[model samples]
Target chain A: METTHAARAGRGMTALRRTSGIIAAVTLTTSLAACAGGAIGGGTEGGDDVFKVGLISPVTGPVVQEATAMQRGFELAIEKINAEGGVLGQPVEVVTVDDQADAAKSTQLAQRLISQDQVDYIFGTIPGDTTAAVAQVAESAKVPFSSAILGNAGVCGQYFFPFGEPNASLLNGLLPQMIADHGTKVALVGNDYAFPRGYFADARTVLEELGATVVLEEYSPMGTADWQPVISKIKAAAPDWVLTAVVGADATALVTQADQAGILDSMGFTGVSLIADFYPGLTDRMHGLTLVGRYSDQLDNEANKEFVDAFREAYDFSDPIPSVAANAYEGMLMIADAVEQAGSTEGADIAKALGEGEVENGVFGGGSFNEDRFFMTETARFEIREGGAYVPVETFPADIEGITPRCA
Target chain B: MDAVVTLALSVFTLFGFYALLAVGMGLIFGQLGVVNVAHGELVMVGAFVMFALADVPFLPRLLLAVLIGLVLGVVIERLVLSNLYERGFLATLLAMWGVSIVLREGANAIFGSTPASVRAPIQENIEILGVSYPLYRLIIAVVALAIVAAVLLVTYRTKLGLVVRATVDNRDMASVLGIPPRLVVTGTFAVGAMLAVLAGALQSPLLGVTPMVGAAFLAPAFFAVLLGRAGSLPGAIFGAFVVALLSTVLRTYLNETLAQVVLFALLIVLVAVRPNGIDWRKVQWKPRTQPAQVAA
Candidate 1:
């Protein structure tokens, strides 16, 4: 009788436990899904009168700093534009969402922004993958989309415009400068992704054009903590300089491990990985490193100086403000100008006006979008200082036009 | 010859970190039947601790991380996990998953999403066989191995080990034998958590201290634990060795993408072939819970 009673209790306990487990799982999943979907700024709707733009920034992912800067630049530009009688003589509204750099999440958010929120334009995404995802959604809906990060690959939609430095603008100027300073033998190491692969391919063409030999091309996956093996390979190749495209948290890890492994001391290091945003994390390790890029906080211009001051005051950010912020802020101005020229918030009308509009000397020394719909960013060189500053070394003319567009 | 030395040292350094992580996970899973998905978050906590206490000396900071890990482990187990253990596997898994998100979001809220780093206590390099290896990495490897060794000694050679193992093998039978299963389970989990915290503290200098950084260590460490016999600690160590060796060798040879594919394939094959675990003679593990029913 006692054995029968114990057996019955055990079965009852099992059934109760399984039921509770299922309930807990369901509750947690629902709560998380809810938390992930939220909008920034006010709940003010974008009616026909307001120039509403949907901003997708990965504010919590590996690219959080870059994403945060993008959002700040977008919001700040809107604030300034609204102060100046707004875009098309009305206040410009923005609905921002954090995608966390996930492609699917960005896709879902983009759909909601278009079909649900009824945003006129979609702006911002850090990595190429998420950019492509957002572009796909925005294109089907005939909405204008732009990204503010560097490097591009794959076939994009007609409505897509990249405000970041294109391959030719970034590498055509950077590789030659690096090779002239270092040597012909160079290695390309980046995190294994579309942008890096395409970035290196562009670098290869430029190197071949300059009669330079590519010693090694390595692409490690994201989240790679140990870079010793990659370092050993580069050391074996004995490249005079190593141009890396490693990005996000992986950038810091690669540089830290490479520095510890004594690779940075031997090779001339410069690439997208050595951005101004990474200065604080690198500290004194990156001192004396030189790289060429579009914007520098030290750029002596009235517009840029004002921007730097405004950005610092608004965000209380002390480090060298990244070029992406400049790109986004300037891109917003360009967008507003296009909207004004078109006299309409329709996506096609805005795209048409932007194709003929100039950037008003925004951050990348200002230029108009080419027939290819690529923003021809200007170039300048900066030396990373001991105190985490990008001191301008040499300024290059904004002569490097973009590569041939590959939009489908 | 130079390349070989570098590769060997790389494997050794990686192995040291993986061993610490896998062993902790093994102990917790084996004793409590809870697959603490928040194990990696605990590591993130340790890294953040180092980042937060930047002015504190490195060694003392590591000690403090260990203490904090112990306290946090006890609190989590007692408050959230203790009641849920009898509720079955899914409950504990979901609970731990919830804990992971909370810790990650909490860290993000506190530290902000900007990645930060601290200076390595030892910045110099020691050349070995014509290869320069970071002195800090070598020291960390040695220390990790020493701690893992101490864990093994206590686990295999101590009476506490016997009581813990017995309770794990059969909770009801051990209870009838006068063993306090709850205390043993809690203590095992605390020690397990502390080890992971130590690994993170030691690795912080080489890492970009971010909330998401711990996510990187989770997969390989998890593979190390699950690839082994479910309850066997030594098996977890062997599994860690395989992971470190395979990853180092594969990444050394093939491009990282292809190497990762091949590595995943091979691990899956190994696990599929030896679902009962690649048994090693003379090593004892607590029987898995379902299997313990047969013993009962």
Candidate 2:
């Protein structure tokens, strides 16, 4: 918004302030198209002969820990890929920037990456809204963009490749068994944000479709300290289990306060983005809870074992690695393969290759996109163990077909 | 009925912490004429102290946090803030703002950014009206309010209170009478910081302790301090009550988003109407002498 306002003021005529500034708008769009000529060409005219991509991560905000994990996984992937003959016969160059989980900052950073850094592709950020912001910028610049986070499958464009879990895969894999085992009555609670609201909206449909009743739906603002009133409401509703989408600090506060209030003991608690990143804050409280997501370090696979061992050794990490980190690892490998298959250092070629090729022995098992450019990674059910390990319990295959349209 | 009961309890719980925060802010704003913009970070310091000393018993941990707050408050005042007060309000405010960044980033570097927690000193569920409430919450609230009352008594009813008030009213005159205004300012700022730290320690068990958590406490406490008359400690407590009650009631009836919007709007309206702030004790009636003279 700050950039837009500045650009508008620079070109806008005072007489046309109240009306449409068509002249300024046209000039800006024309310049934008001209600036995107590098992407249109097969190469960036760089002398280095390196495949470069920019990462806009949120390193200092509510999702800082998750972002850090993703960065580590991303870096590790590049390190391993470069060590093994490199992508397109040259090491991948990654220019990283922090966007603080803010959409506007993300848009600015994405623009900077495309224009100033002259990168072939863009990656990252957490949550759906920031992805949308980066996607818009990536689309405008004609840069292939992707992230290793869950979102609605509908966020599609020609230059987008999502190598992470989507809402459909998450709910389809987890809810049926969850509802069958834990009665029909459910409570939907989360931080009142675009992602959680949309997530719970999808969860609500899945629950009802599985012959369940959503007893209560509550969303509190982010950074809420006193959750007693909300807890009181949830208790009064008396649902069989609580499906929460609260993340970051609020996630810890809600779960901790809920445990103190005896809600976790009385009713079951399970949600996406719940157990792993928050394990330190919610130690023994998360012991028995089970959740489903795309990636877990505990997966009984050879590639996963290598990735997990390498990730732990590199970071000296002991706690449960977040799904985002695992997805970042897979996403980077997929991009590297796409670059190799495209056989060019062009954004258009890379995006095309991403659409055409399957993940070649990446962690989370090799799979292709399920039609609408959404990765069809198999989901796994994991029980939270005492030592911050998401002990894998069940696997949901990547069998979902067709585009299940979620956008108009 | 349970909703009403819950709302009331929630407000009471919220008010305890807000009162602590606002009174501290009110003191700094009132006595030193400097806004301690880093006051919220002071709260984070208390929380991190609790997180770092998880092995210590809760009560001793809280006391250590308060002691740290006192020393931190004095050291900060002497090093960064003491000289800035004479430069201007903006200087002092900016200095405190810089202090806030240092404290926040310092905590982040030491503790890492993952959310941490402290065990509550007490844990049990007790019924209040018809609702089951945490005994720790109730005890903490009462303890906080009791601390506020003790401060109030010391400020209003003690001989030291008279000396402090005289210094604030006319520092030059008080200085002439052998009262060191510098010492008073430093002491008041330290006490204010200690109060905020105390609030944070008590509330740590309920919070997801992070370097960024302090930013959330600043706005409500800012409003609470603003809704009171300058230098009126009781008025600050009342402002805290109003902010807490209004927010809790709105949140009870509406969603969290709507509640925040309505509460912000209400605060804006209140601030616009009473810029000097609300003092119910100052309500007085005057006998009408004339129908009025519209001043042109």
Candidate 3:
């Protein structure tokens, strides 16, 4: 009886070992499958017949309108390209990410597009701060970054191409003319943020140079509503002209408040023209206000007229086309042209081709990049009338005399 | 020289506005155990309501804005706080936060994404101490001060104030004595909400009415209430002034982010040193009553 019991115990131990081995094999297989799934799902590969391009933009927050316009412009350019024949005989594909106009998010989004999405090129960032944040990452990764919105001088990376006039230069170029027309005494008001503050500082310097006296300089935090005290201060100071550098909703508030206070009629108001996107609604209050900008709604160019007509038809209304959108659309076409010229999708080859001084027909007339990969374009000025429509006044070419070497 | 004076006047104008918001927040939190996260939104509503009625002229708009505030106050008490009294602090906080989000997003949807402005009814400027100041800002400051004085009078001298004080002390005893705790609580909350709305309407001419503007005021108002102690109206006002002065000085001399950091640090220290609040001595602590022995 003892021998039989011991034999049964040995058989039980053998059965236990076989069960443990089977469980271990199953766990190992499951782990491997999870790892394989992660690799396949990662956004690193572009499909066989499409050349993927990544577009990062601020599709929400304060700058949503401009961002929306840029996206539309980019889509229009892509459609035109596909109609003729896509890049390198393959259809073009676009992957979009919204940065929400945040600087840190823009940087992360750019990195994801370069490393994960594995896009052939990246385009769009509106504000200067966001542009600067993404440019460094794109430079290090050797990915070509084309900015359609930001025009700050601080954003000059070896791998970056800025497609608009710098904000400081745009204001500075118009300073002498403004002083000559509006007189010497000036009041400066701006949004207490990076872009406005920077542009206002530049405006001050240029105004002082043109023999203008800055009577009052004030800043309000972004989204502030009450302007009574600020307006009262303006009335007391009684500056000959008011130079405003506010953007978005804040701009509307400033103009409306000024009109209500009857300050606009008395003071010659000039702003760093943010008239392209929401000019229609502001027409009544914005009348007689001068704005400095790049593209005017009244520009008589065939490309501009077609773009405006197409945009109006799509929206079923006369929507203002921001110059940023135009620049972004042009940037995409320039990238496509460079790729064709280089005959490859390699970053270094495309960068070299872009800098080869080849003039091409683009949304902005006669588009070409300087040695530093900055687009050369003329600036325009517009006057806002009582009806919220912009009337083109004059166009000024890129101030070749003040073209300084890339600082960074 | 002119620019320096103009800057100083602008800073003072901002300070006056801050003081009004702080005092209102302080009064509600000090007397009632409710922390009003939606105070800024209440102010926003008042501003919009005032703007809509601004065409009726100055005095009418001001009166209408106050009435709107009173209505909003009662509505908030009935719809939001009545259900929250039994659930404790976390529930009240979450409820207020959710309400704020709903109000802000709702305003955005209704008004669209654009900001709307109200013209200051008065557009004159006054020069004082070699600096040019807006007459409108002066008017706002005077009105705010007057409102503060009136609130103090109502709280200290009125019979209703005594009932409110009694309710704050012991709700059970007040209810048992026919004081009607529900009526007092609702009345106090409604009054607080109205004050916030009044402050918002007064600020419309300077800042413009936007859905998100309330968030900016909400933070500073909370800071004032906490620093001043939860139930002291005067303390709240003092706290607001202190915060405004600190912010103004730091913003003028240092970087913007640094100014924010300094204010936050000061708040942390204030809380650490006085955990109960600046006016904790006013609260009465009561001993628990023992249960009666059971008869055998």
| Model 1 DockQ class | acceptable
* TM-score of each prediction: 0.91, 0.90, 0.76
Winner of 1 and 3 under lDDT: 1
- TM-score order, best first, reads 1, 2, 3
Query: In terms of TM-score, how similar is model 2 to the real structure?
Result: 0.90
lDDT of 2 at A208: 71
lDDT of 2 by residue, B65-137 (tens): 9899899889888898888865756576668878888999999898888889888877788898878888898
Estimate, for each residue in A77-177, the C-alpha lDDT of model 1 and write its tens digit. 88889999998789888888887777878888899888878889999989888998998888898999999887763546778888887777777667877
Give one digit per residue, the lDDT tens place, for model 1 in B108-129: 8898766778778998999898
Residues B56-166 of candidate 3: C-alpha lDDT, one tens digit per residue: 887788888888788877887889888986675446555666677787778776764445566677777677777545688778877887887788778878987888877
Instruction: Write the residue-wise lDDT of candidate 2 on A1-408 in tens digits.
Output: 112322322222121121224334653565455334322122344444578888867877677887898888888888999999887787777788777777767777789788888888888888678888889889888899988866563477888887667776777767777777778899888898777877787787777778899988989888887788788878889898898888888888999899889998898789863758888888888898888877777777888999999998998888888877888888888888888888887878888888888875667877786557778777788888878888878888874522244332
Question: How many Å off is the CA of A110 in candidate 1?
Answer: 2.8
- Give residue A362's lDDT in candidate 1 (0 to 100): 68
TM-score of predicted chain B, candidate 2:
0.94
For model 1, the local distance difference test gives 0.81
